[model samples]
Target: MHNDVEEILFSKEDISRKVKELGEKISKDYNRDDEVVVVGVLKGANVFMADLIREIDIPVYIDFMAVSSYGYSTESSGIVRILKDLDLEIEGKHVLIIEDIIDTGLTLKYLTDNLKSRNIKSLKICTLLDKPKRRKCDLNIDYIGFEIPDKFIVGYGIDYGEKYRNLPYVASLKEETYK
Candidate 1:
C-alpha cells in the first residue's frame, strides 16, 4: 500500500498536532452547555474524526453521515445521495460537520443545505484537507488542517479503490495506481 503513494502530504505527527489545536479552539469557542454534536462524514473521516474527538475537552455527541458523490470514480459525480442518516435529532444543537477533505464542495454543499433545513442552532465545517483549487462552489470551512493542491490523496481513512486507508500519513496516489 505504501508503494502506491507518490508523496506524503501530512504525517501522523503533523495531523495529531493540528487536530489537537483545532480541538482546543473548538473547546474554547463552545461551552459545555452548548448542545454540541460532531457529525463525521463516513468512511473517509473515520480516522480523523476519532482523533479529533479525543482532543476535544468538552463532551460532544457523535454521529455519522454517509453520503456518496463518488463511487468507483476518483472525481465526484456531482450528485449527493444519502446512504445513511443521523440517528439523533440535531435541532437546536451546535452541529459541526467533520470531513476528511473538501474538494469540489458540491457534495458538502448539498449536505449543508439538507442539515440546515433541520433547524440546528449553529452549523460549522471542519475538514482535515481543503483543495481550494478544486472548489466549484462558495464554501467556508470553519476549521482546516491543511490546504492542499488538487491531487488524488488517500490515507488516514481516505481510500482509493477502497485501499490505502490504513496508511499512517496522508499522501498523493501514484498515477499508475489509478490510471
Candidate 2:
C-alpha cells in the first residue's frame, strides 16, 4: 500500500497535533455548560472524530450519519443520499459536524440544510481537510485541520473504493491506482 501512494501529505504526528489544536479551540469556543452533540459523517470521519473528541475538554454526545455522494468513484455524484440517520434527538441542542474532508462541498451543504430544518440550536462544521479549489458551494468551516489542494487523497479513514482507510497518515494515491 505504501508503494501505491504518490506522496505522503501529512504524517500521523502532524494530524495528531492539528486535531488536538482544533479540539482545544472547539472546547473553548462553546460554553462549558452546553453539551455539544458531535455528529460525525461516517466512514470517512470516524477516525478523525475518535481522536478529536478525546481532546475536547467539555461534555459531548456523539452520533454518526452516513451520507453518500461518492460510491466507488473518485469524484462525487453531487447527489446526496442518507444511508443512516442520527439516533439522538438534536432539537435545540448545540451541534457540531465532523468531516474527514470537504471536496465539492455539495454533500455537506445538503446535510447542513437538512440538519438546520431539524430545529437545532446551532450548527457548526469541523473538517480535517478542506479542498477549497474543488468547492462548488460556499461553506463556513468553523474548525479546519488543514487546507489541502485538489488531489485524490486517502488514508486516516479516507478511502478509495473502501481501501487505505487504515493508514495512519494522509497521502495522495498514484494516479494509476485510482484511474
Candidate 3:
C-alpha cells in the first residue's frame, strides 16, 4: 500500500484534530436545540461519524443513511439512490448530514432535499474533504476539514473498488494502479 501511495495527505493526528474542531462548532450551533441528530452517509462516513459523535460533549443522536452515487469510479452517475434509509424520523429535528467527502455534490444535494421534504427543522452538510474541482452541483458545505485537489484518495474510511478504507491515514492512490 505504501508503494502505491503517491503522498500521505492527511495524517491520523491531523484528521483527529479537525474532527474535534468540527464537533465543537456543531455542538455550539445546536446547543439550544432539543434534539440534535447526526445522519452519516454510510461506509465512507462511518469512521468519521463515530469519531465526530464522541467529540461532541452535548446530548446528541446518531443515525446512518447509505447512498449509492458512484460504483468503483471517480465520476458520478448524477443519480442518487438509498441503499439504506434512516430509521428514525427527523421531522422538526435539527439534522446534520455527515459525509466523508463532497465530490460531485449530487449525493449530498439529493440527501439534503430528501431530508428537507421530511420536515426536518434544519439540514446542513459536514464533510471531511471538499473537492470543489470535481463538483457538478452548485454546492455549499457547512463544515469542511480540508480543501483537497482533485485526487482519488483512499483511507480514513474512503475507498477504491471497496479497498483501502481501513488505512489509518489518507493517501492518494497511484493512477497507474487503478487505470
Candidate 4:
C-alpha cells in the first residue's frame, strides 16, 4: 500500500493532532445542554469520526449514514444517493456532519439540504480534507483539517477503488498506480 503512494501528504501524527484540535473546538462551541449528535458519512469517514469523537469531552451521540456519489470512480457523478440513513431522528437536535473529504461539495450540499428539512436546532459540517479547487457547489464546512490540492489522494480513511483506507496517513497516489 505504501509503495503506491507518490507522496505522503498528512502523516498519522498530523492527522491525530488535527482531529484533536477540531474536537476541542467542537466541544467548546457546542458545549450546551442540547444533545450533540455527530453524524458520520460512512466508509470514508469511519476512522476520522472515530478518532475525533474521542477527543470531544462532551456527552454526544454518534450515527452513521452511507452515501454514494462516486462508485468505482474517483470523481463524483453529481448525483447523491443515500444507501443508509440515520437511525436516530435528529429533529431539533444539534447535528454535526462529519466527512472524510470535500471534493466537489455537491454530495455534502445535497446532504446538508436534506438534513435541514428535519428542523434541527443547529447543523454544521466538519471535513478532514477540503479540495476547494475542485469545488463545484457552494458549501460552508465549519471545521476543516486540511485544504489539499486536487489530486488522487488515498489513505487515512480515504481510498481509491475501496483500497488504502487502512493506511494511517494521507498520501497522493502515483499516476501509474491508478492506471
Candidate number with greatest lDDT: 2
lDDT string, candidate 3, 18-83, tens digits: 999998998887765468788999989998898999988888788999998888776788878899
Compared with the true structure, what per-residue lDDT tens digits does model 2 show for residues 47-163? 999999999999999999999999898889999999999999999999999999999999999999999999999999999999999999999999899999989999999999999
Q: What are the models' TM-scores?
A: 0.98, 0.98, 0.96, 0.98
RMSD of 4: 0.9
Task: Write out the backbone clash pairs for model 3.
Answer: none
Better of 2 and 4 by TM-score: 2
lDDT of 1 at 19: 93
Q: For model 3, where is the 10-residue window of minimal lDDT? A: 27-36
Better of 1 and 2 by TM-score: 2
| lDDT score for residue 174 of model 4 | 92
Best by TM-score: 2
CA deviation > 4 Å runs, candidate 2: none
For candidate 4, lDDT tens digit of each residue in 1-179? 48999999999999999999999999899866879889999889999999999999989989999998998887799999999999998988999999999999998999999999999999999999999999998899899999999899999898899999999999999999888
Superposition error at 44 for model 2 (Å): 0.3
Instruction: Report every candidate's CA lDDT.
Output: 0.93, 0.95, 0.88, 0.93
lDDT of 1 by residue, 69-96 (tens): 8878898899999999999899999999
**Which residue segments of model 3 deviate by more than 4 Å?**
none
